[model samples]
Target: MPISRDDVLHVARLARLALTEDEVERLTHELADIVEAVGIVAELDLEGVPPTSHPRGLVNVMDDDEPRPPLPLEDVLANAPDHEGNLFRVPAWRQ
Candidate 1:
């Protein structure tokens, strides 16, 4: 099915886009070409082919999580310019 100027205009209105006459005309052709290409792909014979989300097999390379000793409070606060008690002090956002 070929995309029409009215179809493009309707979509533009829904998206809150302000398209010019030239833009609407150009998109009508471009969208039509895209739909036609997808239609060609849809016509392929692949009844036995399993659907895949990615072209290549992928696996997580991360190591298993392990508990570790916490850092010293002095070391953690070493880079802080301002701190109150054990917490970093930040400027108040609201009056």
Candidate 2:
């Protein structure tokens, strides 16, 4: 699973990247190493291992939904830079 220099350049071209010779050479070696690592992982022996998104079990720890008193309108609008009645006001962008 060795990655070629041309393959790296092709990908860089598709991504609209202009890589220097030094960067291209470095990326080619790095990508080849990554592919080789993936190839080694592909040779694993796991017959009945279930695929999981996370290594540990996840549980919903959300609090019980409860109704709460609403804040005063004056308090809510206190920090607003500009407000008209109960809504925020902004400069008109269109005629």
Candidate 3:
């Protein structure tokens, strides 16, 4: 399938792009090549192939969840530049 100049113009318009004549001409050829490549791939026979999200299997490598002692309030606030009571102080956000 070949992409035309009109097709490129339409796509550019839909994408809200301001393309020059040279850019439109270049994209026409590039898009046509991409369409041809995709067409070739579509001709492949994969009837026996199973659908999968990932080609290789995925496994969780994270450590098991375990309860741990909490850090001391003084130790946690040691590096804080601005703190109120036991919590870090931050500027209020405005809408």
lDDT to native, each model: 0.91, 0.91, 0.89
Report the C-alpha lDDT of model 2 over 1-95, residue by residue, as the tens digit: 67899999999999989999999999999999888877886788988998787668776779989989999999999999999899989888776
In the range 26-73, model 1's lDDT, one tens digit per residue, is 999999999898888778899998888877866666887998899999
TM-score of each: 0.44, 0.43, 0.45
Give candidate 1 misplaced runs (Cα > 4 Å). Answer: 13-17, 59-95
Ranking of candidates on TM-score, top first: 3, 1, 2
How do these models rank on lDDT, best leading?
1, 2, 3
Clashing pairs in 3: none
Error of 3 at 87 (Å): 32
Q: Identify the candidate with maximal TM-score.
A: 3
